[model samples]
Target: MRNAPLGALETAAALRRGEIDVRELAADSLDAARGVGAEVGAFAHVLEELTREQARTAAEGIEDARRGGTLDELGQRSPLWGVPMPIKDLTQVAGQPFEAGSMALRGNIATVTDGVAQRLLDAGTLTVGKTSTPEFGMPCYTEPATGAPARTPWDLRRTAGGSSGGAAAAVASGVVPIAHGSDGGGSVRIPAACCGIVGIKPSRGVVSPGPYSTEGMGLATDGVLSRSVRDAAVGLDLIAGPRDGDFMPRPRPPMSYLDSVGRAPGPLRIGVLLEPLAAKTDVHPAALRGVERAIELLHGLGHVTTPIPAPFTPQEWAAFMPLWSVGAASIPLEAQQEGELLELTRWLREQGQGYSGVDLAQALSGVQAIARRTGEAFSAYDVVLTPTLSGPPAFPGELQLPGGADDFGAQCAFTPWTSSWNMIGNAAMSVPLHREEIDGTELPFGIQLGGTRPGEEALLLALAAQLEELDPWPLVREPSAA
Candidate 1:
């Protein structure tokens, strides 16, 4: 029912990927990517030399392992086996530029690989580049001063939502089959929805975030955007784990994510919310239709769907802004660096700076309280369904701050329901199940399925895969010349 052109690797389809060697896949991905990266503005920095070097090494490793007959286990032994992908600029990769899409950190390079990047690299995938993101990932849109806005493949007129926007565009435009993403507040799923793909954000502790963590704010976690639900499940298997000294790692999952695909998630009770929670603007009609369609589909799948109210009152959502501001306070900015930030970022940092420690503690307390209350209410349901975005992909500049409606206002209009999952530390996935016409043009929108607090990642994956089978999206709609 959904179309995937360009970046749809659908890793699970490797079963019958035309007998192409993984090395050939890497070469094809790179070749298809060539100048398209620049066109889509999906890359902050392309690791050209490193990619060629790594691809060769990976190819050799696969060949040697096959010759040695020691390639029994994949992703564990040679999981990636020469596949190529990009890491989000928000995270660090050893020897790669880590600009975080901010001019303020323009010259910075990472000397250490983060948990997500390290896991992917170990799984056998070659990191081809770093994808673009918004400055410090503060906003839900991806137009930075460093490059053109990250535009969706479905239409260049609209933005690929930030801060994982570039990764979504890159994957959507066929630069790679999959890419790393982070969702502090729907960054992964927003862009995934905008670009028409699968973006799965594991529960906060499922994917480790060290040698750095937000001290368990439970707001952000690493994730992946891929062509299919199965591929998303594979990504979780490859990247979800706890690092040494990781404070909040959940108990190791009872089963690997890949095993969950095609598994039955017996008749789930789902609470469906069609309204754009906490936002002042009305949800675009297209988004509402998408949710309604998802509800219908869920019913056909033998799941119970019921309308439910948002987790908290509008006044309670006010606490989220102060907590959001706290993220700005965490960036290590020198006076000069601070001066160089975009006005919205500067304002956010300044606003963050003005909050006293007590104010921050209180805000966090409020946030936790809201999460607790939501958890209690949602305990009755197996999952909560909402539109991943309140509307279709927005045109460039529609959600930009300072020049548009208030940044907070425009952001809420575009991304009304995503952040709440982050606040509650839920496992969430945006599955591209329908297309909606916007302003006379048809584009894809996603239905978000979120697990409860202390979430069930496997159940969510299994349910999504079942939906994918019922409503299969194209793996790669218009891959360039073979």
Candidate 2:
């Protein structure tokens, strides 16, 4: 279990150094997952033999590298090697089944892993299994119709924020050091905030969404959830790049994101946003206190912290709902109709049904305008920070719809802070900055850092690494007294 707690980079080093056998590591991880998965509901599919086989192959390659006096094919024998990792159920791994967290495509299996998953394998990552998500990733809360809701390891009665809820719960509970997560409107960040880990949504095109997808219509990008910021960065480094054919590739980083995290961001001017530009609800007092504590931490770290009012109107925020509905339209229709779709998915699809192509185009153009406006707004600052969620984690059943037109109302109630960055097409991360006092329960609070449109590689990680040193967040401690 101690070895199992190692981060991605550390696990790789131990593997390449031959200090630990990859097979044993894989067995340990699988054992831990089996023991804990039932309690936390973190996995949708667990592949025991497949993981051992992959780990054995990595061990052989590492041994050969030692004999040849050269690094393995994964390049430099990086720190992620031999580490068992989970892919969020939304992503496709070659020869694995991908349900997109719905029963509609219950029998559907993938033929080839996407580029991101391939790159992780190339980096010597051993696949453990697929984590859970809500139906087609429709809601911020993960209470799917088919499987048990992905519960927080800290409190089973509460919901693990979604749609990356399973991934966040897995990492937070030490099932794995890190796991893949995608954000088509805060899927990664919302769950990360709820589970108390680091979840980053890369800027549009920063990471490839195809060989399979063009875009989630500017509402989605792929990234990861991890207990540590560095683990998240290294995972991104393995997968961030342009595929053979892409409609819009993100501007290349001058260097690897892993390298960027090590460099200190010179004293920064950080602007704190207490209110979400789009949400009608105000942030809770505890969340506000978390922001205040982070500001103090930033001041101690030699950065200037200032409170700034954002320049967007409520009408502008209201206008983007249709664009989100268009994304609702984007979920493969087959996936939507699969086995009784969840309440949230049925609700979003109905919203999508009302929109025409012209309506979608108008929504796209409007989102682009907001992106332009937000880019200008951040021109005066180095980074903008805000709480990841407006309130603490919600309990199971607190966010469900009444199974009709009210589904739209349910979605609005479920997610309040995560969709705006997707509309602006900016990279945003939910860093676990603080915990709550009640029951000494870990209420993971997020500090959202968004950079200028194309400046994602430099700004997002730089700020994250800085915060990593300033206010290192602890794991959302499991409640049992060991």
Best by lDDT: 1
- Pairs of residues at least 3 apart in sequence or in different chains that clash in candidate 2: 9-79, 94-113, 104-338, 104-339
Clashing pairs in 1: 4-477, 7-174, 75-79, 80-123
Q: State the lDDT of candidate 1 residue by residue for 1-482, as single tens digits.
A: 23443332334235123255655666666665557766777888878767777767766665666677655543354444566668888888878798888889888988888777888877667677888898889888898766666878777778889899989888877678888899988999999998888999888788888765544566889898988776777777788888788777776677778778868987999998776666766777777887888777789989998889887866787788777786787788888887778877877877888899899899999888988999998999999999888778887667875632287678877887888888888899998888866666668888899997574888888888888877776554232211
Query: Which tens-of-lDDT digit does each residue in 308-399 have in candidate 2?
Result: 87657656776677776667766666643634676566666678779988988888888788778877887777777788887777776657
Per-model TM-score on C-alpha atoms: 0.93, 0.93
- The list of candidate 2 runs beyond 4 A from truth reads 1-4, 71-77, 334-339, 403-414, 479-482
